[model samples]
Target: MRKIWDIHGGIHPEENKHQSTGTAIGSIPLPPEIILPLNQHIGAPAEACVSVGDKVLKGQLVAKAQGLFSAGIHASTSGEVIAIEDRVVTHPSGMSAQCIIIKPDGEDRWTQLDACEDYAQLDHDRLVQKIRAAGIVGMGGAGFPTAIKVNPKSNKHVKTLIFNGTECEPYITADDMLMRERADDIVKGVQLIARFMGEVEETLIGIEDNKPEAIAAMQKAAEGTDIEVVVFPTKYPSGGEKQLIQILTGKEVPSGGLPADIGIVVQNVGTALAAYRAVRFGEPLISRVTTVVGETLTTQRNIDVLIGTPLSFVLEQHGFKAEKKQRLIIGGPMMGFAANDFDVPVVKTTNCILAPTQKELPLAPPAQACIRCGMCAEACPASLLPQQLFWYSQAEDHDRLKAHNLFDCIECGACSYVCPSNIPLVQYYRASKGAIKIANAEREKSDKARVRFEFRQERIAKAEAEKEAKRLARKKAAEEAKKLLAEKADSPAAANEKTTSKPGAAAAKPQAADPATQKAKLERALSSAQSRVERAQKALNDEQEEADEARLDSLRARLKQAELKASEAQAKLDEFGKAPEVTVGGEQAIKDKMAMSPRDKLEKNLASLNKRLSTAQERLAEAQANGAATVDALKMGVEKLQQKVNDAEQELAQLGPDSAAQGAAETAPALSAAEQAIEKAKAKAAAQASMSEEEKAAAKLEALKARLEKARARLTKAEEEQDENIDAFRAGVEKLEQKLTELSN
Candidate 1:
């Protein structure tokens, strides 16, 4: 014997279910067209598979499940897909959603189905997959996918499975009639679910004692099975998922938790029958038994209506009187919503369509302010403080609303129905819930952005630290090398001193006076002078200060210093070093080394002149393109570079042809990088002079396009960095783009 548990609060409204339950379940004929919504379930919307003008059969898949939580949609009857577009759907919002419309061919044909007579022999996963493929969902108005509800977490075990035949809503007799007429199929569905569950200790069916016929029918079907039909006292909302679980198992599901969390799984009687037909007979959920009852219906009864059939068609077939109907409600009167658009099609969750007159279901009076009433709290089944929630929600105090457990409200309309002050408490709670969800989503996005910003800052700091460490190491190495060089210059060192107490006469030569040492000193001096010249030129070109005569003077002085250092080194070699004039071959070597110095100086000057000329040409081109005022300054720079180049050539020519033969032997082995660059530039100039006009134009166009692309890339980077020179880069890009466009045309 199972003990029935009591809930916190409930109301006993008039159960006008007899008007629909009196007759046997009837079948409605097919309408001219059916409109099926893709988002019939609670998760992601299903994806449509059929296009307009495609032929389809009854039970054929028209829309496939989009995700794990969604269910598939199938054709209710054989037809041609006439439209796939947004249309009115069965929702409280009365909005249009994606739908597939079909025009029936009257054949009522079905596609091939894979049925399993002995489902118990199949694997559990296979059975679940079969149910999912059949497009079965919770028909109990929740519309949650049934495959998801049945399969609990691996760690959680279901001890009892409850079939809710209570049908406690007022004026809704679909489930009750189903239990009375199809009890054997319902029982078979129960056994099938139990087998899928694997370890259920008890399988129970709960129905209100008001429907004796339903209880007797279910009991007779479960004579030899493990199913038990338990009849309890009739209550208004005893059919709620949580309330039914509490009534049968004597366990209160924790707030914001499901019944499966408490080792229980509940399914509506209609859902179970659908599952049975899906697995045993291979019929997809294309139709359901809907109760058509109210004052406006000439015939009040249950009819097996096809899914996606328009409500207008069903009501019209039942002798619906439009003039007498005051409200068109879907579902029971207590929890149903009023329908404003009659073309809205019935979905998987729809069970009842009530066309009641104004007297049968009167409109609620205008809501007045709360008068400190406790009736709402007394009527709440979830034990929530309704008045406080209403106050906080109206005040927009979200934190207080959360603290009062606003989400725990089932929105069953029990509170508003029992409110003496007539305050619409449920409406206020719904608004608050929407606000809370939006707030949570925005907060989550902000947190993710903050995390990304912090990560980027950390990376930059790490890179800067690594660069600083490398800089310090290089400074230390340079200082150590300088110290070692100074030590060698200050004191004479002998290699034999470490082996003997006294140094040999040959080892008495000072390390600083060695020929190699002198050569190294001269090389270092030249390299330092060349580096200074490069730095001065770079500063002048980068800053674009053509009037900086002081900078030009400084560059000239540095070049003179380099020349003086070369001369002093040559004089030193002539005085202290062995004379190359001693041998017959030595005379030629002496002349070669002497000529090498002047050649190197001229080569360095020529390279600098070439670089200045290139810089001047670039500035001149920009000034011409932008109509700037700096053309004269740039043209003067270009003329000075040309003159310097001419002078260098003259000097090279003045040195006789013998000088080249004389210096080639010695300078070839010791040519500096600058001297090598001068040779390459000379070769390229000779080649350019030999090219045809057409070839030159093509090459020039290619170069301009390359430059434009590079400039555009720099401009983009500068914009992102908010650089101060962004305008400069943008101007350069535009100029290059214009030049390329002209050349292309």
Candidate 2:
């Protein structure tokens, strides 16, 4: 015999088990309609797999498990899906949740199933998958998915397996009846779970002294095996996972820790039988043995009720006297809550449908204030300070509640049962636990968002730094180029080359230097100014956040200055292009050319022709030697050069000395005439430059009139020809007219 230990605090409520244990487990008639809530477990809700108007067979998957922590839901009988909407569910808050409603067709037909003759041939993971596919959960009312509980982390080695047959709650005998009837199946399930646990050291079934028949049946089934049936004194709430572990192994599970953390696992006997049927017979958890008891019902016994059967239907089957009913509860009287509506359906976690008359179970009076009594603390199975937790809960001090380890409370109603003032201590604890869970979830979400925001800010800062570095590099390169250009422009060699490359080099030297060089410098200034304008504009546009007003104003001002500079540079370049070129001392150059004699001019011409002929001959010879593509053109040029040389020599030979002098004297007259015209144009430009304001305005008006007339004529011609540039011509005419009017004003 294995010795059993005791927990910290417990209460022995009135044993009401005999009321439902008199008869064998019976089945209720098929309900006309069933209501299956999507969420029947502790985690995420299941997702619906069927739609309304779809025909489904018994044990068919109507909703799938949403995640690893949730359980699947199936049809309890062959039926047609009537509705898929929110309906009142078996929740503590009496709220509505998404559910699947079905109308049975009276035939309990089943779908195809995948059963394994021998579970030992499969691996541990395969067995767990089978259990998961069957939608089995902790049938002891916690409704935690069994698959998740059975599969612990690889590092934690399970040494003991405990089957909880201690149905210590008042007016609930579902597990007790199940143990008495399905002992062999329960033992087989224990063995299968032990094999899945990988070499568990010991297997023990913990039952109370009140269930002698269940204990003897379990012992007989567990005989000739390592499994042991351990019986202990009857106490309320000893079936809690933590308390049971303590009773069986004398090792208390750590606060806020699971039973697996201590190398032990406890499961209800009903859950074990469900696993056995799921793996061996391929039957999903479509129904459960629910104890339908209380004085309001004439027939009080355990019944195999289908999941999703309405509470009203179960009551009707038991000949319920609604007039005598005081309150309708779902679980045992100690831990169960009053049902707000009779339409709420049964779920996997439901173990009993308790309906008692007012004389049998009366409602508690209004709760009174606490007296700081230590009885609640003494009766607390978790050994927590209940009075202090209650005070903090009333104050809504979540921090204080956490410090008192409020999550360790099992909500078994022991504290409330022993309270002198009937404070409903368990209700306060439950509400506090929910608030803490929500607060923790919100905190985790806020932390993640903050991390993401910080990362985004860092990325933007890095990009801005890189952009600023590139801008600085470009600015330095532009400055260096400007410096090199200035140095080249100011060199003595540049001035000398500019002077010698123009016509009448000696006379033009006294005028301004080359306009091309100045224009190039102005163009560089314009480019730099434009670049600054673009950078400033980009800076303004990229400022997305609340920036300093002074900085924004400064950027705008810089952009305006850059634009002004760029416009000034562009105007200077345009003025430079429109300016006419002037040659000074033209008369002296004409006189020097006219002074040459005819014989001298002929000889000069002959020498120029001879020089050209020699150059052409050299190019022709080079082209022939290198096989150049321009060989034919070069040969033709050489022939032309020889002919010109012959003509020049013949002309030079025929000219006499006196004839050369006379020819030079006659050319002087024509040269004198051209110089007079050049002088007249220079005088006119000088007079215009020195004109007063009134005179200048009159001259500009006259010029505008003449331009307008010419533009109008061109516009008329373009219109006649239907030219594409007619609009441009018309625009030019309008501008000239506007200018003429402005100058006149």
Candidate 1's residue-wise lDDT over 320-381, tens digit each?
99999988999987788889999899889999999999888888899998998789889888
Q: Model 2 segments beyond 4 Å from truth?
A: 480-496, 501-745
Go through the candidates in order and give the C-alpha RMSD of each one to the true structure.
14.5, 15.6
Q: Number of backbone collisions per candidate, in order?
A: 0, 1
lDDT of 2 by residue, 1-745 (tens): 5667878888987878889999999998898899999999999999999999999999999999998889999999998999999999998889999999999999889999888997789998899999999999999999999998789889889999998898889999998899899999999998888888888999989999899999999999999999989999889889888998988888998888888888998888999999999999899999999999999999999999999999999999999999999989989988898899999999999999999999889887888888887998888889999999999999999999999999899899999999889899889988989899899999999999899789768866976886687668667766876787799878999899777786854554254554655666676676666666666667676563446888777776666666556545654565567655534576565566566665666787788778767866776788789996445545555666787888788787787456654766656554444565797799999998899989988887887887788789878877986644689999999888887777667
TM-score of each: 0.67, 0.69
What TM-score does candidate 1 get on C-alpha atoms? 0.67
Candidate closest to the true structure, highest TM-score: 2
